[model samples]
Target: SFQIKINLTAPTLIFPGIEAHGPYSIVGKTDTSLIYLNNKDEKRVMYLVEIVKFCDATLEKVLNEVKLRIFQNKFWKKPPLLGELDLDIMKAYEREITKRLRHHKQIRRWESFVNGRPILPTMKHM
Candidate 1:
């Protein structure tokens, strides 16, 4: 069996006088058998269906929808940091989410490479 795991750790930020929060993590895992017999029951191949499914769900459904929503609203507090950065804290949150998403994409690509099956280009390219 082969196992692949990926984790994204969100940073904890501290404004000058305010307390720190988070440094939370989100993890995704894939497990697959090394060999699978085909329909004819005469051939075995490196079975990566589980890994592909995991990567698809993690990158598209979980990361893009669920995690982005959490980062945009759930984990952010606006009024507290309004005075510190001299700008809307929402902007900072947006920047942080973008950075984290980019990092996650890179990690996914690297994981795909290591597993010998690269993923197709994401929606951004199309």
Candidate 2:
């Protein structure tokens, strides 16, 4: 019988600073075994995935969406500022979206590398 093991850790997100959004990085590993019945040999393969939002998507699609405002010409339009509202709601949404994008990017980046190399670094594990 052959045995395979899979190990996954919690995802990690990093916020550079107030000005900079972040460079979502997801780091994890998996281990599996491939046994050759004829050759009586076993091979192990590791798989990893990461995605990076180094472009406008990070701010426009993600951040803006979470901001819950329509943006035109690089400007965000919010509801009338005449009402008093809970600031915590905005903060919670922002944090959640930020973390989600970061984790998602990490996975996407890894997948892109595995699929093919397009002027990008080669993936060590697939």
Best by lDDT: 1
RMSD per model, one decimal: 17.2, 18.6
The pairs that clash in candidate 1 are none
lDDT (tens digit, per residue) of candidate 2 on 21-105: 1112111223211111111222211111221212335333435543542222125354542112223333343555577677766
Report how far off residue 77 is in candidate 1 (Å).
Answer: 27
Off by over 4 Å in 1: 2-87, 121-126
Q: Report RMSD for candidate 2.
A: 18.6
| TM-score of every candidate relative to the true structure | 0.31, 0.30
